[model samples]
Target: MADNNNTLRTGDVVMYKNQYRATVSEVNADAGTVKITFDTGGASTVPVSDVKKA
Candidate 1:
């Protein structure tokens, strides 16, 4: 697979684990992680590769 760096960004809508839709609160390029705030009022730090545009 190709590198997906920079594919996700803060404020972008994404689908995460379990197919939940969430908004990206932050992006940590150095750590390759993203902070996502789910629509259901929850958040998590997940690997960038683990999420995709909703």
Candidate 2:
């Protein structure tokens, strides 16, 4: 995460590829990575640059 102050918590919905909605499960600002559990039941680690708050 470029901005650590802008923290996202679990259950926060975000937009990913294909307009899919995912919840923030974990965040690693140092690595600019966030672990998201998608509405489709899939979890993945995505770079902060690839996501946007929904």
Candidate 3:
């Protein structure tokens, strides 16, 4: 689950789905989602519950 104090922001580094580390590109706080770009060159929008600071 997404931590209340772990509010994400653009340019922050984070782990996605406990699978890969990725850079946060955008945050939709109202929607409870974030768009991230992986180090391997891919991007995706995921729920805040699936991400955490790296």
Best by lDDT: 3
Q: TM-score per candidate, in order?
A: 0.82, 0.77, 0.87
Model 1 scores worst on lDDT over the 10 consecutive residues at 1-10
Best by TM-score: 3
RMSD of 2: 2.3
lDDT (Cα, tens digit) per residue for candidate 3, span 1-54:
354678898999999988899999999988989999999998999998899999
Candidate 1 residue lDDT tens string, 1-54: 334553887899999964899999998878989999999998999998788888
lDDT of 2 by residue, 1-54 (tens): 344645676667888774888988988878878899998998999987666778
TM for candidate 3 is 0.87
Q: What's model 3's lDDT at 14?
A: 98
Runs off by more than 4 Å, candidate 2: 1-6
User: Candidate 1: where are CA atoms >4 Å away?
Assistant: 1-6
Residue 14 shift from truth in candidate 1, angstroms: 0.2
- Residue 23 local lDDT, model 2: 89
| Per-residue error (Å), model 2, residue 17 | 3.1
Better of 1 and 3 by lDDT: 3
